[model samples]
Target: MITAIVLIQTVADRLTEAAQEVADIDGVAEVYSCAGDVDLIAILRVTNHEDIADIVPGRINKVAGVLDTDTHIAFRSYSSQDTEATFSLGLE
Candidate 1:
């Protein structure tokens, strides 16, 4: 799967509404409202890179309150669980 991290900026007053709308999009796996340089962060997982183009510019950017977006495509994923599992492979 292709994973994309999207940093979103939305109209201040419409933050909640925009987040809900983005969360409802098909390719969006998760949406988080945060306090920082960006208002919301969306996690998108799809089967192909082409889907990122269609989902981000074609849909997300068109949402009513969305002001701007910066998207990053993930090359690799590392988590504590993954690391632990790798190190403990023979312990089980």
Candidate 2:
């Protein structure tokens, strides 16, 4: 599975609506309104990397309130690292 995070920038007053609309897209797994430079952050899990090229620019950027998007892919998960360390230590 390929996982990516889309940092979305929206029109000044449309963060909520834009987040909801992006969340409704097929490959989106989660969406949150973040308190940072970026307006909303969306988590997407797709079957392949090519799906990102097709879905993100094609559908997400086309949403009305969306101003711009920056996507980041996971190379290594911190949560997975933590889990592995804990399990390898043989702790309950």
Tens digits of per-residue lDDT, candidate 2, 31-88, equal 9997889998889999899989877899899988999999999876679877888779
Can you write out model 1's per-residue Cα lDDT over 1-24, one digit (the tens) per residue?
999999999999999999999999
TM-score of 1: 0.88
Q: After superposition, how far is residue 74 of candidate 1 from its true place, in Å?
A: 0.4
lDDT of 1: 0.96
Error of 1 at 55 (Å): 0.4
Model 2 residue 74 distance off true place after TM-score fit, in angstroms:
0.8
lDDT (0 to 1) per candidate: 0.96, 0.89
Inter-residue clash pairs, candidate 1: none
